[model samples]
Target: MTIDAKRIVVLVPARNEEHSVADVVLEVSAALPGATVVVIDDGSTDRTADEARRAGAVVLSMPFNVGIGGAMQTGFIYARERGFRAAVQVDGDGQHVPSEIPRLIECLEEGADMVIGARFLGRGDYRAPLLRRLGMHLFSAALTVLTRRSFHDTTSGFRATGRRGIEFFARTYPSDYPEPEAILLLCRAGYDVREVPARIRERESGASSITFFRSIYYMIKVLLAIAMGMTRRAPVRRRGEER
Candidate 1:
């Protein structure tokens, strides 16, 4: 399963990350030479789009700020429309290491529809705040139960998706708190979703959008979203079928 580098697209979804987006683009280009890197500028008032283009990345500037889910779906749609065989997600804030991307791609090559770069897998010394950590644990537990499989890091945004995953996600991606919900969605849809250890660093600039009270709000809202998702039947898909 040796995929051509030209057929792979690295999707970097960013918002107001002008300070670090260029560096991230450069690193992704260097790490995966010949792979197409597209940065989705989520309506940043700053110079995010300009910085990304200057760094040799294809920039997709949104009309306004669509959150992470909308930004990422735009990337997947681009990948699908352009007939990319695989899509890799790297945050624009430079928290995700480009060098570790190969690990996730390897899992995809090994037949995983999607591969998550798990931070708690002992490969990195990354630590989250107390409330955030608890929320992660809750989401992980709920996903494990819902999917009947183990999930170590449900909130990690670092991930890679093969063709099947790209097509599915392009059509049906959650709009809010998508990381954890996406795992359950793919798993329930009968996709091979796996996780691998990867290193994640602190963001180079800007603070997290999830603040103290926001964390609590995020937890409740996401749990409700997950519950609603569980009530619906997963879409039927024929394995290996292309849309």
Candidate 2:
């Protein structure tokens, strides 16, 4: 079953990415014609919002920097409220290839509640720094054990979700380090989450948000969040199963 492009929304969460946000918006528009491109400007001091608007994207400007997690939740909330059937997350820095969005949507159509665009799935030559690679491997292993399912790129931000995922995340999403935590949340709730190979490019401009010290902090905080999440009861029962 081919989903209509009009029922999909491409969400771009940007912070201080004035130089590349416009181009990213344009690229997404071209890649997925007829889809709504909404840019969640996470309190960027630069002209990120203006650039996105000028590039023909709907802009949601936050009052202040709410981090990636908050920005993404805002997009999901919008998707849920606006009645979009599916939503795709494309980063503002141009790392994610908008052209690959259809692959994710295909997974959603195939009964996946959420689809992650994994970078290290043997499809791309994209390489992370040594420290970041180690973190990814560690998170993948931890999530594999906790969820009883394999995960390769737990830290990947490129993703897409169907209506079920959109509604669930809108209601309850983590505030920090949400990517990995979100996987656990969905699995515990018995949602089908899958990963697909995707090629990623280096950021078009600006430095990465994860600095050396912040990487350490991110790892520690996310692990703690996962541990706490494990003890909490599943927010929703498995799909198509009795309560």
Candidate 3:
């Protein structure tokens, strides 16, 4: 299925990813020539914004580091404001393959409110370490129970969403560890969520924010957020409202 590039936006959220952002932005532009590429520079002390801009991507620099969730929500707000029909999110760390973005958009075109590009769903060389894999499994199980849906890779950040999902998230998004919880949020809000197999590469540079201790904290914090989300009411979509 072919989609109008003008109707789609590739949102790259970066922080101190100067080494990798340029290549990622270039690859995304090559993969989808006409799509708008926007890099949310999450207050990087490095030259992330400069590299992204040089690579032909529109840069939105945050005043301070707002983490992944805040950066992504800012991108969604941009998409909504610009009247984009769809939005695809790929990490700026060079882990997610830009070429696979089409596969995610295909699912979205087929009627999925949101499509997750899952790493563990198929045979591949990208493997998380034992401890990290265990943490992922625990969260995947928790999401499955909460949403009553099978989820193989809840932590996958490679995802695409249609207008409704983008608009909904722009209004209210989780602050920390938003990927898995965002999926559950869409499901509870009556949106169709789907997943497909995709590949991941090792980061080109820089250390991961998730450490042995931080991964544990991430699990606890995300789980609590998901539980709280279940009890809260989703906002009603108001028509004729400006994005």
lDDT score at residue 212, model 1, on the 0-100 scale: 96
lDDT of 1 by residue, 1-243 (tens): 978889999999999999999999999999999999999999999999999999999999999988889989999999999999899999999999999988888889999999999999999899999999999999999999888999999999999999999989888888877999888889989999999999999899999889999999899988988888799888676544332
Of models 2 and 3, which has the larger lDDT? Answer: 2
lDDT of 1 at 74: 94
lDDT of 2 by residue, 164-236 (tens): 9988888878887789999999999999999999999989999999999989999999889999989998777
| Shift of residue 107 alpha carbon in model 2, Å | 0.8
Error of 3 at 174 (Å): 0.7
| TM-score per model over all chains | 0.96, 0.96, 0.95
lDDT by candidate, in order shown:
0.92, 0.92, 0.89
What is the Cα-based TM-score of model 2? Answer: 0.96
Worst 10 residues of 1 by lDDT: 234-243
Query: Per model, how many backbone clashes are there?
Result: 0, 0, 0
TM-score of 3: 0.95
Ranking by lDDT: 1, 2, 3
TM-score of 1: 0.96
Indicate the residue-level lDDT of 216 in model 3. Answer: 87
